[model samples]
Target: MIPTNLVVHQQSKVLELTYENGSTYCLPFELLRVLSPSAEVQGHGPGQETLQTGKRDVLITSLEPVGHYALKPTFSDGHDSGLFTWDYLYKLCENQEQLWLTHLEKLAAAGLDRDAPMTKQGHSCGSH
Candidate 1:
């Protein structure tokens, strides 16, 4: 179920994945960024998931391979921890519509705008 081709369409802001079966999925950069599997986003346990907002314009600045099993994408917002595995990517392709709907619902429930800028969190100091 591994993709045979991966094309980054900067103009369209999507990552198009083509599999051997000829099925293709065009995943939006914003979706990838918001739904990233990084601990910063997903958190360390259940009920700790962070709702991502203001990511409608996010981009994939770079994509690097992680061995033969996954991909690591550096996002325009400086988030690069998510590791997208082949199986996980395939699932994303299959469930994108539902996932997007859910994201939108969460945003609405939280009274957040998808196009608004994300407020900086944590310390005021620049030190990480």
Candidate 2:
């Protein structure tokens, strides 16, 4: 299903996507950043997932179209690696609520906050 409209609610940091199939999805800025399909996040091969950190207050600065099937999101942190494909964005939107809840749960389990202090190297420490 092709998205008919993609709206970014800057105040709420949510992306509202409406598809031609009558489905509407709302995804958070943080979720999209962490779950980016870019090689930087997903890595170059399997078993190489890189956990993103310090993205609690991150926001989407811009959303640019990549040809006809994807969006190139420019994040506030200058990250533009993820090319959010229509299908992938739809999936994230569809699973937004659950995914966010799970993310929160994982954060809680690890005793981490989104705004937690960064280490000296400017990166967050691994999950405890």
| Per-model TM-score on C-alpha atoms | 0.91, 0.79
Candidate 1, residues 1-128: lDDT per residue as tens digits?
Answer: 79999999989999999999999999999999988988777777786677888788788999999999999999988889899999988989999999999989988988988887777655323435
**CA RMSD of each candidate after superposition:** 2.5, 4.7
Q: For residue 72, what is the lDDT in candidate 2?
A: 98
Worst 10 residues of 2 by lDDT: 119-128
Clash-forming residue pairs, model 2 = none
lDDT (Cα, tens digit) per residue for candidate 2, span 17-88? 888888877787889988899877776688565556688778899899999989999999878979998888
Once superposed on the true structure, which residue ranges of model 2 sit more than 4 Å away at CA? 101-112, 117-128
